[model samples]
Every structure is written in C-alpha cells, then in structure tokens.
Target chain A: GAGVSQTPSNKVTEKGKYVELRCDPISGHTALYWYRQSLGQGPEFLIYFQGTGAADDSGLPNDRFFAVRPEGSVSTLKIQRTERGDSAVYLCASSLMPNSPLHFGNGTRLTVT
Target chain B: GESVGLHLPTLSVQEGDNSIINCAYSNSASDYFIWYKQESGKGPQFIIDIRSNMDKRQGQRVTVLLNKTVKHLSLQIAATQPGDSAVYFCAEKGLDGATNKLIFGTGTLLAVQP
Candidate 1:
C-alpha cells in the first residue's frame, strides 16, 4: 500500500482478555508512532519507534500496554488484561524523520466490553 | 506536564466562508506546532505546521499562525466546505529529542453548513 495500514479496523474484546493491534508503516519510513484517542478527544501519545528500537515509551499508560517494531517495518501493540477504560481508537503514524510531517492510518477502534 | 486547550469546543460556519479555530498551550519551550484534522473514524491528518522561528505558514487552502509570546495557535481555512468539516487539533512537539512526543489539545469541531 502507498500509505500506512492498520489491521482490525474494529476490535471487540472482553475485560481481562488480551488483544494485539498491528500497524504497517510506509515502506522505508524510519519513524513510527502510536497514539490513543478516546471519544470526543484528541490522541494521546503512546510510543514511538525510530527503527527496530523504541526511542520512547514513556507515554504508555501502564505496564499492561507494550508495543514493538521488531523488524523495523511492522509494529504491534500488545495489551494484557484489557479493561473497559482501554477502549479507544488506536492510531498509527509514520514519518520520514522525527520532525517531518506524519502520515496516519485509518486507525483501529478497540472496544472493551 | 504540558497542556493545550481550545477556546471553542465547536464552530459552525457557512460553506465558502472562512473558518478559524484557536488553541492555547501552556508550555513556553515548545518550538514546533502543528495542526491536524481528524475525520470521523479516521486518524488525524496533518494539515500544516509552524516552527518557533516562523510566525505564519500557508498550505493550499489552510494557514497556521503561531504566537510564542502568548503561547497561542490558530488554524484558518480559506473556504469552508462540507468535506472539510471535522475535528481540528493543535499539537506542540516536545523539544526533547529522546521522547519524540507531541502534546495535543482537546480539539475544535468545525461544522461547515451549506
């Protein structure tokens, strides 16, 4: 695809269950970012990957939320023991450089029941 | 912690009219500011950006203004269209290189009415 892509446009899970959201950034892009947006609000930063390594993960809410860009091209966000408060639209973005404009995917909407 | 806020939660404007959305940030050290438009069920799309060295920047039909003294930002759309209706967010990029984070404001819902 020419743009960033995200899997499972919508995910419905039960509390205490686990879920993984995937993001495929644009080819050759070195910077990838993850953010979470609640209803009627802006996205809050989650984490960012410079390549295969995570340069920043401080925005992650807790230990239950983790993300990895193992191959430096595809990234996965893992959530353990999902809670109702975890429901939101998980967005993925990629940029040529950290300061460059970001290209975003449609996002994966997760609903915890 | 840094916080950004919008002056108005919503704004309704007639099609073909100009629309302006305002935002305020509390951080004085922020050097990069960006405006993003998010449609329903879609991720935020970058509209425009301005650095601390520049006060104004224009892109296509949109213009972004930055005022460092007051820590204010504004996004102006030349001609409002129904397709342009969406939530606009103002974000300030943290100067810290290690984090690579941008703090976003709540947002302003722009309604373009025909």
Candidate 2:
C-alpha cells in the first residue's frame, strides 16, 4: 500500500512569495496532520483535519499559514508572504482515525531565501 | 506551559549494545505516547507506543516504559544494530477529545558504530 504522499519534494522561493504544499493521505485515513520541522529538531504541529473540516488549527504559527482538505482526502497547505523563518521541512501525516498511529510522508522541504 | 523534553541530545553506542532514550512530559492530561525514528532526509516513522493505563509495552527489539508518577517515558532497544542509527523523538497526546495532534520533544540522535 502506498504511504502518505507529498508533492514538490523540494521547493526554493524568494521571501514574500506565496507557496502551496500538497499532501495525499493513505487510503481510508480519516485524520490528516501537518507539521513543520527545523534542522536537528522535532516536528512541530501545524494543523489537522478529521475529515473535510479542520479539527484543530491552533498549531498554526500565524494567519499566514492555512490548510484545506476538500472531499476528505487530498490536502493543501498554503503560506502567504513566505519568510526566511518559514524555511523548514513541511511534513504531512495521516491515520486511520483520530488518536491512531500516524503514517508520515517524506515531506516537502521549503526553502525561502 | 506544557511541553515534552528529552534528557539527551545524542547517544553513541557500539552495535550489539543496548540503547536507552529518555523523555519527560509536563502535561499530566496526556494519555498516549509514541516513539518515532527519523533518518536524515525522511519523516518520522512510528517505532512503538504506550497508553497511560499500561506501564510498559514491548515490540520487536524495542520496549517502551511509562512512569506516570514521574511523568517520564523511556525507549529501550536491545542489541542495537547499525540500521538503528537515527534521530528518535517522543510525542505525547493529551486526552482532549477528537483532537489528537501530538506534541513532540526535541529528538535524540543515536549513532551506532559497527
């Protein structure tokens, strides 16, 4: 079975630009999560969706970070006016249900110059 | 503020030696915990998990011990191999309804010398 899939394995952009990262969760997974990880650090929570709606968005750093999961499957994490501080690996994970062990994708490395 | 932290930043051991990684969490409401392993260019991979009700759980070549009294968790790997070299993280999730997002601690890098 295919694991969680993330697009644009690497993305390099200038500061103040807009970028979108996509995630495809495992089949039948109802819970999807996004996290950001810096060098030599653990992943930090971002947002999660239980189905089509976000169950929690509190982990989002600011208003510039937004995510959406339409039709209960594919999800896109959008960032507005990217900054150098946002340069990190963006990870996506999914589970069979809430509280279940998460299966993670390789992640998209976003580099804002 | 609630947080999860590790006691060690790195551990270097010879292959065939056992390895232990420790974590401390501040949120007493947290009922579930997990250990994840990550390599250089990949995301975390689930290693093992334990619930608050249980004190210990064992998986292949690994064991997770939980001590709610001290708010501590530890992951032990038996006869560690070269392939076990990676960064290990401990994640905690509180019992807050359907929102199961995890709070992760700073990782510990395990370097195995074969």
- Leading candidate by lDDT: 2
Which 10 successive residues of model 1 chain B have the least lDDT summed?
B1-10
Model 2, A1-113: lDDT tens digits are: 89999999999999999999999999999999999998877899999999999989999999999999989999999999999999999999999989799999999999999
What's the TM-score of chain A alone for every prediction?
0.98, 0.99
lDDT of 2 at B58: 99
> What TM-score between 0 and 1 does chain B of candidate 2 receive?
0.90
**What DockQ does each listed candidate score?**
0.56, 0.58
- Report iRMS (Å) of candidate 2: 3.4
Candidate 2: segments with Cα more than 4 A from true spot: B1-8
Ten consecutive residues with minimal summed lDDT in candidate 1 chain A? A36-45
Tell me each candidate's TM-score.
0.94, 0.95
**Candidate 1: segments with Cα more than 4 A from true spot:** B1-8
Model 2: per-residue lDDT, tens digit, B69-100?
99999999999999999999999997669567
Q: Among all windows of ten consecutive residues in candidate 2 chain A, which has the lowest summed lDDT?
A: A36-45
Residue A104 of model 2, lDDT score: 96
Give the per-residue lDDT digits (tens) of candidate 1, residues B1-114: 423433438999999999999999878988889899998888898899898999999999999999899999999999889999999999998656745788899999999999
lDDT of 2 at B61: 99
